[model samples]
Target chain A: MEWDWAFVMQILPTLFEGVKITILATLLGSIVAAALGLVIAILRRSKYRLISMPTGFIAEFIRGTPLLVQLYFIFYVLPDMGITLAPLVAGVIGLGLHYGTYAAEVYRAGIENVARGQWEAAKACNLTAFQTWTRVILPQALPPMIPALANYFIAMFKETPLLSAITVLELMNQARSIANFNYRYIEPITLVGAFFLAISLISVIGLRWLERRYGRIG
Target chain B: MININRLGGAVSAAVLSSLLFAIPAKAEDTLEKLKEQGFARIAIANEPPFTAVNPDGTVSGAGPDVARAVFKKLGVNDVVASISEYGAMIPGLQAGRHDAVTAGLFMKPERCNAVAYSEPILCDAEAFLVKKGNPQGFKSYADIAKDSSATIGAPGGGTEERLSLEAGVPRDRVIVVPDGQSGLKMLQDGRIDVYSLPVLSINDLVKKANDPNIEVVAPVVGAPVYCDGAAFRKNDTALRDAFDKELAAMKQSGEFAKIIEPYGFSAEAAMSTTREKLCSASN
Candidate 1:
């Protein structure tokens, strides 16, 4: 009933403590996603059906199911199979694995967007496959990915709530617990939204700066 | 040598009687309406000691345990537990998301304005969960307030958060986790100094975690017990009354306590009166 500015002030500092966990999960999750995306992108381009076909299916399968279900599977079911991970570890892995499938498509699009003439030029220079990709194609292809990758970082920040399902007490979970105890969802939940908005606004501005920087590189 | 046909007819009749008596519905007018629809949808949060989603994806818990028995007695053959959050359970009922909530939703005055509750299925006191030795020596939220480093995990819209806040534990010190599992994990990992939750719910967490390091600090600060029960939309007064009648019968017969006690609850606890006089403001 009463909007206690002092109470909000008191709560804000504690939630700030959780920001480290939030940033850590998103940072670690994004790195895993980037690596996994690269692998899937390469697999999709492989000449062998054995490699490409199942890689595509696995990507589709991970994409098809809800991230929450995947999280539950990793946290609840995997332990029975003798695979165990801490809550945050399992959360980052599941979040990364799920989003990586989508990122693989982004990477695929970026790689494909590299002008066909560039590949021919690399060959004309007598460049090997690694040299051709590293020196010629990837340098051109990767810049466009910066915006999309930055976007994934933002998306991952929003998706941190899913980590709560796997028992990772990020910002939203903290808000929910506060709301539950106080019987006032309005304050704590509003604070969660405000916190999200604040972070997201900063991220969007930072990402725009990245996009512009990478746009010139393009 | 015997009349086999007669024996068969007599045996079938006895089985039918047993089944008929299992769930004694009001047979009041609405009973036919519910039966015509074919299923009684019960909302649940799927948390243990209250409602849980079984490994097979079926639902069970003290709340459902009592509800299921009452439904069986009411002749509601198909009782389904629909997943719903504790905060949303009342709204879900009001919006017709389900016929009723079988979760451990407390019957507070605020909730009473929106929904009617059946007799309390389980009465639980709020309590603090601490490390095995209780290294911080937490007797209540005062202990938490004394320590600047102390943090508590209280799920959203749960009573623990309220108690902690009321005790002057800063809003920041209380981590509003989404569920008991995370709260317990946070406590285990030392990310939280204490986890304040329903004694029963925390007990369920301790059992589920099966960790030796965590234990319940008896009778949480400020209150002895809170009454939690099945809630129905205020408009469903008839259904609420029917449920109450059957639940009262169950309690009187001692069947309610028998069914729920195994889930780390006391049948006597449920039977205890929830008179306001009994609920004290200070510990």
Candidate 2:
């Protein structure tokens, strides 16, 4: 019940190590999610049903399952199929895959928001399909998507705690270990909450700045 | 949107501030509360031989059996059981989630500081589950530490994890496997080099796993034999003392042995040590 400042100081380094892992996992997972989401959005919008239908089904399946169960399946169950991933790699992949499905919807909405006239204008400019997507469509579409992507990045940060179940030793896992070793819960748990709040608040401020800087479609 | 966000923050702040004054006022007598309720809620890890949940949905095993008998004598007619992890059991007791923990949670100095423990109810030695033929020839946690590639699996926050770390095994090499079952599976899958648990627990798991590739190494080197007591919150010292008295009487009457002996625990080992002796011993 008593908060021990000395104990807190002693454990801060260990917790900070965990914070580094948490941030690493979130950053890597966010990158994977963003790229994978674009792939999923592109495939789901394919002209052929043969490609788009299966892509849509796979995205929905990943979205439907719990992230924790998927992490377990990837970390523990995948070895049976002769695929073994290191814990951090497994955790990052799990988080990225799970959030990528949701991010795909955001990408789809961003792409759809581009006017039909923009596509026609690119065609009239004698641009190739790739040039049209890269120069005209995506440049306009990406700005509005920044805030939504930032929101998912923050969401992925919160979900990083679940990576502990697979033994990734992230921030919450570090706090639990400290609590278990010291038999003091209040301080470490409260510190974890504070850490999460501070990071989220910072991310929100950054998101607002991005929105103000790039939100205008024109 | 800003107003809603402000309101949500304000409400959460108010709630968090209110929790500062909301500590559950402990009743003067915990035993009296248990007696009035007619059932004592005890936490148990579903590790076989120490604590197990039967196929019939009943709780059994040496720990619960000893605890149930002691509580029954104290006029608590029933002992309801909640299956929890070894690390969470103590916090569960402190959080008022359980009346007692009889999950063979060993009485180490750090744990002794957390909860009031009754006299010893079960005594066990450390053991490791390794691949058959003991390919790595790992005899102790030190052996695992010496081998750079070896990964040892132990329950998170349990005594075995502490032992491995104390023996110089790096934190990364000591994989915190979730439970007994998962530890065995991890061993089978070659996910970890060794799975550490109590001797009886390893025996039980290896038997159930029925895998010829698995072998048990008992009395792990540099690890001491430890005993566990039914742990109660520090405020429940009166109830714990009463429970200890009843446990001593049961030991003397041969009733304690009759209950725990069937589960592969030595009643003599449990009776030999006092809680004070075990609690003061730093692991």
Candidate 3:
């Protein structure tokens, strides 16, 4: 099939607009995932089974279900219950909740890797529990978690296409829209692939940089 | 600490396996693949009456029913359907996501540019669902455009949407939705003045909505003439040709009419016109 440069150029602005939505969703979703993951990791380590068990189960449940269903439930089902969210809001929340479960496992591993002696020493030095966690455990734990989080950031970028199901109009959705309206697939869809690959490659390089920088932190 | 190490290895292994299994099958000799697999991966529009997913996840519809019988006669047993929107069906087939599409999608020339479509399976007419009693007196697209308050709900990339746009309906006035469900929902919620689509599909949507306030705007303008056809990727010339042959045979054998009549379709009107004339003349 012949590539149409003019058509590709015409749809570029719209596709780029879609890319902006995707980037925003990924960034916002990552923030929610990181915060919720840290909370789940902390709760899982709590002394009380009441706190830890349910938290662990919640994380596992979210992890077990498909992201597509979760997205549908959030976007469609929630409106029936009198909770209406903008498509983009629903997308970010669904993405965040789904990935947060995975990140919790990462956080739990990182936190547990801190030597037991560090906690013992912190307590002996009259450090508060908050101080012990913030200064001692987290500082050591966060470095290892950074690379995994960066990987998740990359995964989320790729998954942004699925947001199209809810009419959020991301890059893939825009490609479909362009092709549908113009009756041409060679240009718009090809541009979507190129755009996704370019962003993914850049993210991979940035992730490698982060891994190196964080690995050297310890 | 012990659990930490174990979890890391398990997670890495799972991720690796997911990546390994993610490779999709390449479409080389698609007919052979279908013959070997015993099912053609068909793209379907997830619209009721035309096509809907059962509670058990099996697909059934007038379009799928006719297509299935035709394929069965061709010695294909399994008809695996990938649910997609009307606009996405063609691209999905071309992308190798599905071998063919039986979405009751109309045979239009612009679409013919992208994919090879089989003979007409059924003819569906364009119509709309408006607020009860036709509050705006918007019987047609022209009527809707004449009034400032009338917002027409157009399913994005579908035939009605393209037609509405061509009929001089302003883009700002045309509220484009992603699917039939959303379009119906928008009309039910009173967000749009008219939900435009084919008549049989509209009947299905109306039954599903079950709201007395919403009614079908009868005698839809712009000629009640359309033929739904099976769509295949342009590259699959052999498969499309075989399908056309089987389709013509089904039409002559009266199996096509038997399949469509049960789904609230006028099979006679759908099949009276042939593809050769329709394809050449339709915009």
Winning candidate number (DockQ): 2
Relative to the unseen true structure, what is the Cα RMSD of model 1?
11.9
Candidate 1's C-alpha runs over 4 A off are: A1-66, A69-109, A112-139, A143-160, A166-218, B1-32, B52-59, B71-78, B170-173, B176-186, B204-210, B261-264, B275-283
Model 3: DockQ vs. true structure: 0.24
Write one digit per residue (lDDT tens) for candidate 2, span A99-192: 8988898889888889999999999999999999999999989888888888888999999999989888888888888777666788898899
1 or 2, which is superior by lDDT? 2
Window of ten residues with lowest summed lDDT in model 1 chain B? B274-283
Best by TM-score: 2
lDDT string for model 1 (B74-100, tens) is 778777888865655654565556777
lDDT tens digits, residue span B1-283, model 2 = 3799889999999998988875563747989988998999999988899999988999999999988899999999999999886778888899888999999899998889889999999999999999999999988889999999999999877889888988999877888778898788778877788999999999999888888888999989888899999999998999999998999999999999999998999999999999999999866
Task: List, for all models, the DockQ compared with the true complex.
Answer: 0.16, 0.55, 0.24
| The 10-residue segment with the lowest total lDDT in model 3 chain B | B22-31
Evaluated on chain A only, model 2 obtains a TM-score of 0.95
TM-scores of chain A across candidates: 0.94, 0.95, 0.94
| Per-residue accuracy of model 3 over A153-190 as CA lDDT, tens digit each | 78987888888777676777777777778767788878
Give candidate 2's TM-score: 0.91
TM-score leaderboard ranking: 2, 3, 1
> Which candidate do you rate higher for TM-score, 2 or 3?
2
Rank candidates by DockQ, best first: 2, 3, 1
